[model samples]
Structure formats: structure tokens, C-alpha cells
Target chain A: MTSLSTDAIPHAQSYRGLVARRLAILVGLAAVLVLSVAVDVSLGPARYALGDVLRTIVAPGAADLQMRVVIWDIRMPMALLAVTVGASLSLAGAQMQTILANPLASPFTLGLSAAASFGAALAMVLGVAIFPAAVGLMVPINAFAMAMAASLLIFGLSTLRGVTVETIVLLGIALVFSFNAALALLQYFASDQALSAVVFWTMGSLTKATWGKVAITAAILALCTPLFARRAWALTAIRLGEARAAAMGVPVRRLRLEALVLVSVLAAVPVSFVGTIGFIGIVGPHVARLLLGEDQRFFLPGAMLSGAVILSATSVLSKALLPGAVLPIGIITALVGVPFFAALILTKGRKAW
Target chain B: MVSLALEQVGARYGRREILSDATCAPVAGGGLTALVGANAAGKSTLFRRIAGQLRGPGIVRLEGAAPHDLRYMPQDTGMSAALTVYESVILALKQGGGGWRLSAAELAAVDDVLHRFGLADLAQRQLPELSGGQRQSVSIAQTLVSQPKVVLMDEPTSALDLFRQYEILEALRRYAEETGAVVILALHDLNQVMRACATTLALAEGRIIAAGPTLEVLTPEMISRLYGIDSRVERCSRGCPMMIVDGPSGQARAG
Candidate 1:
């Protein structure tokens, strides 16, 4: 008979240490986010001192009126939007990877972004909108609707075939190609001015960041975080494969459907508001998985924070690169993300889950 | 004592009948029972039906334990490459109602199971890094850590070396005896069944042809009929029965 021994005490202690280390990483990510927000807010056409920016943030009415407007009305919303979009995309990507059990799967890889772009193109070029009236609002609404449509299509196909990970991923790839072709067709027949609008929208920007968009994205993220957290253990179980997870008493089909819907919401909202910011969805989760292993309790939040940090930092870089011309946030993300992704692949990606 | 009873258990996959009218004598807890059959004899389908994974017409009644107390391990271990052996075992415990965090006692119990399976040294290693036999052992450790009342395993020793297979079977037999759990395994090794299992279930063409004590049910005629091979049943030096196959019989030899 095996006896209860003190040997397990060290394991408990190490487990606690792992939790503490993950928390520290989270704190460090939060610090990066705060610093990026500060830097992004301070740099622009009219440079505001960091002290003045801080002062205006502390008490909005006390600072100079123009300075307050610049910090609060303009830059603050954009920076906060960066955080929201980043966190949402990252968390959604992490969920997708776990549920699909493929390390390479993400919202972008699965064609959600491409489908959203098609919807936005349709709204901008043809005036075909999901939400009529209010010209500026139609793009986000149409984009969100199309993204959800793509997710549903994938989900429906997988259900017909018993919801295997390979089926979902294969169908997602097919959706990506189909949507991209549709997007190309739209661009080919558009007027020059409309074509340029469609092109700029596809490039992705934070220039349209406003309080309304921020509020909507933040609300979606806030509402979905707890739902995802409640299913954290089940999501972790899914990494063991669907059959194994089902045998472990997890309702595999229901969990997969719920997680797919949540990921669509998480991905669609941000893409609607800010166009398609690509790499944060894939890279954020990889970074988090590298730092904190596959424990969903920490990995989920770590992914969100990592995405937030990457996007917020990119937001700062987008403006700081040139004096008055802001680089496209999507372009900057790709440029930065490509090298980092390559380096990760060469270094830690082989062994990473 | 607890027992498991199945009445008229049948299964099919898209009109291909895998099992039909397969009934078992009530197997009491605290012993190893072996389900032995040929390649296409529906051993896995029957096991899945018992594990509640496959839905079919059946009445699987447990005398003293709830259905939730039964755990099934399929032929494929399905261990996640991302999770270490210890984390996977803990995940299994937590999934089985151990709550959000593992208590000290739970951790110790997991450690004891790992040690029993000779997996304590590889506890921190990822599942993909281990050899097949080691991975299978870890999977068994994951199942046993939950301390279920009924354990069903499909080809649990399929990947292990001969000595390791013997070791794992011995540990499982001891575990069943100590906890009074009903342990059922789908096995191919006739020698293992003869040595380790208290009861033997012989199946052919989706039906149970014979079921009783291992020595009594596994006769020379049953072996020849089940496998289409002429075989001699003899007693080993230790007085346990063993089967030695002579050759293919009748139509098989003509072909």
C-alpha cells in the first residue's frame, strides 16, 4: 500500500510558485500597456507633455481646453480601443486553438477576418448594408454580421460531420479562400474612390477610434470574459482531444459550439470597429503559451494581456515612425509580427503547445 | 458486494451490426474480467456500449454504484502533448469533481498512483516525449487517479513490453482487489487472460459464445472455434491452463 508522504509538499509549493510567476507576468504586461498608452497619447501632430497628459487624465476639466480635447477626445479613445481589440482577439485566438486542438489555428487563419473584410467592402462600395441608415455605422455592422456568418458556416459543416477538429479547420480554410475571392471581385468592379476606401479599410486603422466603438467593444469583451472563464477547465480538457474530453464528461459538441460562438463575437466586434488587425490573434496566444504553459486559468488571461501589450505598443510605433503621418496599424503589426513569429518558430515554436 | 449486469446489449454502426444480443452474467466487484475475441468480434463496440459512449438498446445496471462511478479508457491513450503527465493526471482528478484546486490529499493520491505505475520519474515530462509504453502507463495512471468504482480498459497492454505488461496487469489486479472495483479489460493475449483474469468472456460474430471462470470457459474446442485454428489446452508448470495453437484447420488448410 502507498502511504501519504511529505514528498507531495514540494509539488504543492511549486504549483503555488507557478501561479505567482504567471501573476507577475500579467503585472508586467499591464505595465507595458500603461506605458504604451502614455506614449501613444503624448505623440501626435501636436505633442502634449507626458505630465500634462497625466494631469488632464486625472482631472479632465482642469487642463487647457485644447490639450484636454487632444488627450481625451482623440488619443485616449484610440489607445483604449487598441487594448480592447488586442485583448479580445488574443483571448479568442487562444480559445480557438484550444478547442480546435491545432496550434496554428486563429481567427485570421480560420477566415473570420477575410469574411468581415468582404462585408465591409460590400458596405463601402455597393451601399449594400446589414444596418440601413447612418452610412458610417453600416461597415461595422455588416462586418460583424459577415464574420458571424462565416463562423456559423464552419460550425454547421462540422456538426454535420460530428464536429471533429480537422473538419472545422479544413472548412475554415475553404471559407477563407471563398471570402477572399468575393472580396477581390468587389474591389475589381468598384469606382476608383470607392476602391480606395475599400483598400484603406482593409489596411486596418485606429483613426476611426471613438468613444462609441470603444464602449461597444469593451462591453462585448467584459460580457464574454466570465463566460469563457467558467468554461476554462473544459477548454483545457479539450486539448486532450475531443473523444477523450467527451469521455471525461465534457459535453464536447455543446462546448465546441459555445466556444465557437464566443470566439466569433470576440473576433467580429473588434474587426468591425477597427478593420482587421491580423497577427495579435495568432501571436498573442503563442506568446502566452510560451510564458505560461497550457493551464487555462492563467493561459487565457495571459493571452489577452499579451495581445493588449502587442497592439498598444504597435499603436505607439504607428505614430512615432513619422512626424505627422501615421502608419497603418495593420502594416506595422505585420512588419513587427513577421520577424517575431519567425524568431519564435526558430526558437521555441517546435516544442510549444 | 457490487455487481454489473447487462441485459440484451446490442450495437450497430450505420446498419452494420457490431454487437447483437450480448448479455453477460453479473460480474461482481473486486476481480479482473477479460473480454476475448477475434479481430472483428465487436470487443471495442461492446466496451463502448458499457462506457456509455455508444448509444444503443441495452440495460446496463449497476447494483451499488451510480453510472458516474464508471471510467473507461479507450485503446488510444489520447494523452495531450501539451500537458505534462502530472498536470494531465491532476486535470483528470479535477474533471472528476475534485474542484478548482487540488487539495494536499488529492495531490498525494495522484503521486501514489504515479508511483504505482512507475510514472513518478516521468511525471513532469510531456506526454509526447515519453515512449509508447510509458505513455500508456501514464494514461492508466490518469484513469486510476480518479479512484472510480468500475474501470473498463480497451487493449490497455497493447503497447507495453512483455515485462511491463505483466507489471501493469499485476498492479491493476491488486488495485481492483484492494478497492473492490469491477475491472474489465478487452485483451488479445490469451496467456495474460489465463494468468490474470478471474473470468473469461469468449465472443464470436457479435455474440457471447461462452462465459464463465477462465479455466472452464476457455477450452480447446472454444479456442478452435473462436480463432479457426486447431489448438491444444494444457496446464502450465504452476497448474494454470495454457493454449498452444497447432495450425489452421479444415477449410483454412484447403484454401
Candidate 2:
């Protein structure tokens, strides 16, 4: 018989260490977010100093209309929108990697984003179901509907043949190509107004983001967070393979489906607003895994925070780089995500992150 | 309450029947059972059938209420090398419901299992960092941590060197005694068959050649049939019965 128990050992040190590390990360994220918002507010045709903005936020009576408009309408919406989209995309990407057990598997890898792009394109270009008299906001409606529809399509296609990992990924890739082709066709036969709309949709933008869209997307992601996190333990088991996973009571098939659904919702909601923001899903998970280790408890939130940090910073940069011009959020994310992805590939790629 | 029986158990891969109507009785309660044979002797296939990994009508009966009562350590270390030893063992315990609130006691037990096989310091080490022997040691610890009533280990020591092999076999025997778990391992090494197993099931071409008490069952004729060579039954230092194959299908070997 063994003489010692982990219970007998004092792990206060480990606990303290983890707590400190987590707090540091959270503080760093908060600092970056705060700094980015500061930069955003102090920018544009009318600049608001840090002291002035802080006082305005706290002592509203002292603030002028321009300051109020800058803080509330322009900067606040952009910052909030960036945080929401970034967190949702990262969580989806991180969970998909674990579920598919492939670091390369992300929102984009499963064709969900491509399908969303198509859906967004169709709504913007065709105005298919846009009734100018009633709900003039057809693109958003079309975007959400088609994004969810694309998600369901990928889900259905993967499960149509019994959910094997290889089959799911292959089907997702195939669907991605199919949806991209459809989007291409939509692009080919568009009016001048429709052409720019379609191009803008593909390029991705958070400039049109409003509090309503952020709230809706946030609600969906919040609902899915638990389901995504619940599989942390099972994802650990699945890495051992299906036979071992089953042997361990993981219910491999059901877990696979649950993960697929969770990721789809996570990806669909974000893509509904941003179209196919490539690499956020792919690189976010890698960053999470690398920074927080492979433990899902930390990986999930780490990825979300990392995504938020990247987007918030990028939003500020994109706005700064193009004065009085709105750069596509997709390009900013691509610029930020691609180099990190290459770094992940160069380093941890061989390490199986 | 813990007995396993396989009847008319046959398996196929496409057109090839790896195990054909294999039948065996429960040998003994405590020690190892060497399902010994040549490379393609269907030992691994039989283990899979028993473990319920491969679907075949094998009239398989396991006494435990849950499959966790039985453990299968696949020959392929089948564990992802990307994970750490702590993570892998934690999974085995999780499956067994060893308890989610891993107190110091339980966590120590997890670590101790590693230490028993010289893996104490390597608990946090990733599987890829492990040598073949270290990986096998971790795999064994994962299998035994559940205190499984029946653990079907396919070549548990196949990856280990000579000394490490003994360490693993000794660990298995101790585990069986401590937990009273029925341990079955498939082995190609005849010496290992002699060292740990209390019984032997000699299989050749998807059929049992001889099986019973390890002493009586492992004979010159049986080893010859299993290994397809001229063999002589011999006695090791501890008076345990073993076989010596002088050459493949040649003569003049006696012990």
C-alpha cells in the first residue's frame, strides 16, 4: 500500500501560483483593452484626451455634445463590438480544435464561415428577402439566417455518414469550397451597388456593429460557453482515441455531436455579423493552447481573451491607419492572426498543440 | 463475481477471420495469463474482442457491471503522446470515477503508481518526452490505476527493455494481488510467459494449441506448434517451467 496521498500534501503553493498567473493575464488583457479604447477616443476628426474622456464618463454634466458622441456612439460601439466578436470567434476556434482533435480545425476549417459569407453575400447582393417597406435590415437578417443555415448544413453533412473525424473535416472542406463557389457566382452576377456590398461582406467589417447585434451575439456565445467547456474532460479522453474514450465512459459519438453543435453556434453567431473572418478560429485556439497549456479550463477563456485582445488592438490600429476610412475587420484579423499562426506552425505545430 | 468467458468468439477484418470460434475458460483468479503465439496468432484480435473494441459475436461475458471494471491497455500505447502522464492517468481514474475532487491522497496515489514503476518524477512529463519504456510504464499505470477487475493488456511490456520488462511484470503481479484484479496480457516472449503468468494459452493460426496451468500447458510440442520451431520445455532458476527454441523446425533440443 502507498504511504502518501495527494490529499495529505499541501498544494497551496500551486494554487497560489496558478491564481497569480491567471490574475496577471486578466490584468494584462484589461490594461490592453483600456489602452486601446483610450487610443480610439483620443483619435479622429475631434480628439478627446484621456483625462477629459474619463471625467465625461464619470461627470457627464461637464462633457460637451461632441465628446459625448465620440465616447458613446463612435468609440464605445467599436470597442464593445470588437470584444464580443473576438471572444466568440476565439472560443469557437479553441473548442473546434479539441473536438475535431486537430489544431487546424477551426470555424473556417469546418466551412461554417464560408457558408456565412455566402449567406451574408446573398442577403446584401440579392436583397432576396429584403422588404424595403417592412424590415429594411435584410443583410443582417440574411446574414444570421444563412450563417446558421450553413452551420446546420455542415453539421448535417458530417453526421449524414456517421460522425468520423476524417469524414467530418473532409465534408467541411468540401462544403467550404461549395459555398465559396456559390458566393463567387453571386459576386459574378451583381449590380454595381451589389458588387461592393458582396466584396465588403467577404472582406469583413465591424464598422456597422451596433449594441443590438453585440447583445444578441453575446447571448448566443454565453449560452454555448458551458457546453463548450463541459467537454474539457472528454476532450482529454478523446485524445486517447475512440476505443479508450468509450472505455472511459466518454460517449464519444454524443460528445462529438455536442462539440460540433456548440462550435457551430459559436462560429455562426460571430460570422452573422462579421462574415468569414478567416484565421481568428485557426490562430486563436493555437494561441490559447500555447499560452495556457492544453488544459481546456484555462484554454477556453484564454482563447477568448486573446481573441478579444487581438481584435480590440487591431480595431484601434485599423482606425488609426486609415484616417476617416474604415478598414475591413477581416484584413486586420488576418494581418494579426497569420503571423501568429505561422509562429504556432513553426514551433508548437510539431509539438501537437 | 468476476469471471470472463469467451465462446464461439470469432472476428474478421473484411474477408480475413483473425479469430475463429476461439473458446477459453477462466484459467485462475490471481496471476497472469500468457496468450502466447506468433505475430499473426490472433492474440491481439482476441483481446480487442474481449475488450469490446471490435464487434464480433464472441459470446463474451464480463462479470463487472460497468466496462470500467475491465481495462484494456492496447498494444499501440494508443494514448496521444501530446498529453502528459498526469493527464493520461487522470483520465483513467476519471473513467473509473476514482473521484473528480482529486484530494492530495488521490493525486498522490496517481503519482505513486508512477513512482512504483520508476515514473514518479515524470508525472508532469509529456508522453512524447518519455522513452518507449517510460511510455509503456505510464500506459501500465493508467490501466492499473482503476483497480480494474479485469485488465486486458496487449503486450504491456513489448516496448520495454529486459530489466524494465521485469519491473512491469512485477508491478502487474503486485497490482493483481493488491486489488485482486484479473490481469491478462498477450506476450511473444517465452521468458516473460514463465516469469509472471500463472497460466498459458498457446494459440496458433486463430486456434488454441494448449492451455491450462502454465507448468503443464507449456510443453515442447506446444511451443513448437505456437512458435513453429523445434522446442524443448525447460526449468528456470526458480523452478518455473519455460521453453527453449533451438532453431526453427530443427531438432536436438531437450530440457
Candidate 1 clashing pairs, residues 3+ apart or interchain: none
Against the true structure, candidate 2 has what lDDT?
0.73
Q: Write the per-residue lDDT of candidate 1 for residues B1-255, one digit (tens) a residue.
A: 778878889999877888888888888889899988888798888877888888889788887778888888877865654666788888777776644565777878778898888887887777667787887898788788888888888889999999999999999999999989988888998989988999988877787878889888877677777777787787889897788888876632110
lDDT by residue (tens digit), candidate 1, A94-143 = 99998888888999878999999999999988999887876668898899
Q: What is the TM-score of each candidate against the true structure?
A: 0.94, 0.87
Instruction: Kindly provide the TM-score of model 1 when superposed on the true structure, using C-alpha atoms.
Output: 0.94
DockQ of each: 0.41, 0.32
Interface RMSD of each: 4.5, 5.0
- Model 2, A130-237: lDDT tens digits are 344435666766666666776687677666655588878888888789988998899899888989978888887887777787788778878987766666667667
Q: Lowest summed lDDT over 10 consecutive residues: which window, candidate 2 chain B?
A: B96-105
Give the per-residue lDDT of model 2 (tens digit) for B108-209.
566667667777677667665677777778878877776678878888888898888988899888877776667888988887888788888877767666
Error of 2 at B46 (Å): 3.4
Q: Give the Å error, residue A11, model 2.
A: 9.7
Q: Best candidate per DockQ, number? A: 1
